[model samples]
Target: MLREETAKLLMMIQGAYPNYKPDNKTVTINTWNLALSDISFDLAEKAFLAYLRADTKGFAPAPGQLIALVHELNTPQQLNELEAWSLVEKAIRNSIYNSQEEFSKLPPLVQKAVGSPNVLRLWAADGSYSEQVASSNFMRSYRNEAKKQEEYEKLPADMQQMIDQTNRNSYSAQIREKNRDAIQIMTTTENAEIEVKDEPTGISQQSDERLKKLIEDFRKI
Candidate 1:
């Protein structure tokens, strides 16, 4: 936010908390501006209002607190673990004939934890598969994915960009390594074929004659 917007927010805070008298007004504004510049003024104002309603301490909020509140405001509502598992259980029951269709109907996060339609089919077909075990595993995976998404959403735009770039780089490196290994395997196989073709003719003939004699002996027996 701009310095003027930050100053306005601080003014609101000062009015709310009579004892919140900063000795250096200019320094406080600059600090708040620097900390909150990435956030929009409207969002910052909303966060301030939320903080005021929720706070019982009667103390003025710092920039960090406002940033936290903004993240909370921005997060979308999500299903709890039990609700997510209930959907999966229903899908599993119906997956016997139309596994792919059932899989497609799952939420993105639950779909990730379930892996694929083939997995659902396997679980459905296996009488030995334990519903309790499956429920426990799915809930754990769902919780982890939810937490990861929440943390990612809370990151600043710049930080998110950096993380995305790093992931792209890592994926590119893995692809390159896999290609290199394939090339090495193909080269080694080609070299082996060349060596076999270049073997002494005398040795090759003897090996063929021995194979023919063994075939004749087997026929006679």
Candidate 2:
């Protein structure tokens, strides 16, 4: 799990170090090694956050030493474009370096773009895949809405389709994003999908109690 999150953090930082050349040679946030000393499913969430905070004050990157260590983690070359970008981002973020005057001395444009929350979260997921899955939380209610339709289909001829299908021309969908902080809710979704079946109660009831409980839990965040 931490590996998944680390993969995301890498993607975000790659954006920070775009190929475009900056006026200043100084590096703002030096990413050291992303590979944690150790990790497991238990510490996945906290471990994920710790990597981001690693770039902050206390966890400043070292000199060539830390940066040199990044090359060791071997992400597959066949990774999608987004995946490739994330692997790079994680490397730079976790690479060795510090908030030296050299980094601070850089201009504001570089600072804001690199340190932005969206960027941070982007990197957290390696790419938007996990984040996208995460977003399914509230929006997944739409699936319940879909499942409701599926249920209604199972109904006798007397029943009505209450789902207000969207028009093709006005098909604007809002995407829910996942982040390290809000990851567990995604897990609940998988569990919900398997357990929440339509046959037990039938569409008349449309009782997706399991999925509902998970979505409600995510809403708290």
Candidate 3:
């Protein structure tokens, strides 16, 4: 992935600086070898692509500039009040913890996002809080969905159709997996019942109960 990204970046650089003829390759392969070792392909490619789009003056950034951009991307900033609160709401709804004590033991990121545990507890118990939290959450979701839909609309007709088909195939695969699991569970239950019936009349009630419990647990999974 890094090599592929490196190749794309080099191509972009050559396009931007056509006059800068090189004695060697577009980029020294050895230089990329060292850079790729430290940063991920996604970070490098995203930063480079962002630079290409934002730097309208068309001055090519040096290779070190790309690495610096990766650092800028990694540096975390304080979230605004709404973003922090939305994250807290998401954690409260989705986290496995069932009690305040358990919630307190959640990851530090979750703790910090909540801003204050007391406020979270109060909001969680308030009916009005749900509407507010949901509105904030929905706003973010709507913006993301709108952006994706806008991008899709910009694509060529054929490309849009291809993406739609891929999404359909993914959904179909998930349905098939669920069906397979259901069928397996039913077949296992029937087979177990048959085995129990075939057992000698001396089979204990405890053994029958154990088999039923196992089947119930497996089916839940």
Candidate 4:
């Protein structure tokens, strides 16, 4: 929201709660603008109205609270666990022959829970598959996926980018650690000439050079 819009919102809040007062009006406006600039004025106003209707405490909402309200207003309605399970159950009826089509028709969250068309087909063809167990599992998975998507959507753009970068870095570190372990195992089993030394230094110079070369090769990979 723009500075003017933010000021208008604060005015609305102040009007609602006469006792609420800010030490510095200009600072408050600037702070609110900084927090809500990504939101449009219309959406912010709607969020304010929604909060006003639901508020039990007569206190004015903080900037962070307004942001949360904005996100709540913006998020699309999601199917409940029972409703999602019903869709899956319907799809399973035709999954034996038209699993791909049925799977494609499901919502993204439902598709994530189902995993694949083949999985759906398996559930349909397998007589031993229990509807009670499958329904419970699919509902649980759907709820989990929905929650993850909601939380991710509520995060700020910068925070989302930071999380993505952290995940990538963590995955890269795992891969590197696995490769290092594999290289160590290969060195131990494949290179008999390179021997461990009991001297002050742990490994022989030849073994050290070979290990260094292996590390460099793994780095390239």
User: Poorest 10 consecutive residues of model 2 by lDDT?
Assistant: 70-79
lDDT of 4 by residue, 119-206 (tens): 7778998989999999988888888898898878767788889987897679566665655454454344333433433342444455
Q: What's each prediction's TM-score?
A: 0.64, 0.18, 0.31, 0.64
**lDDT of candidate 2 over 1-221, digit per residue (tens):** 25454444434444544543334323222221223323233343333344445545333223222222232122122223343334334433532221222223323323222432333334444543454453333234333443444444333233332232332223232112222222333333333445666443443133345445646654664
lDDT to native, each model: 0.79, 0.35, 0.56, 0.78
Give the range where candidate 1 is weakest over 10 consecutive residues by summed lDDT: 179-188
lDDT of 3 by residue, 12-67 (tens): 67787676455676456556645555566778778787787788776777667776
Winning candidate number (lDDT): 1
Model 4: pairs clashing at backbone N, Cα or C within 3 Å: 1-37
Flag the better candidate by lDDT, 1 or 2. Answer: 1
Candidate 2 residue 108 Cα shift, in angstroms, is: 33
lDDT (tens digit, per residue) of candidate 1 on 33-66: 9888899999999999999998998888988889
Write down the lDDT that model 2 would get. Answer: 0.35
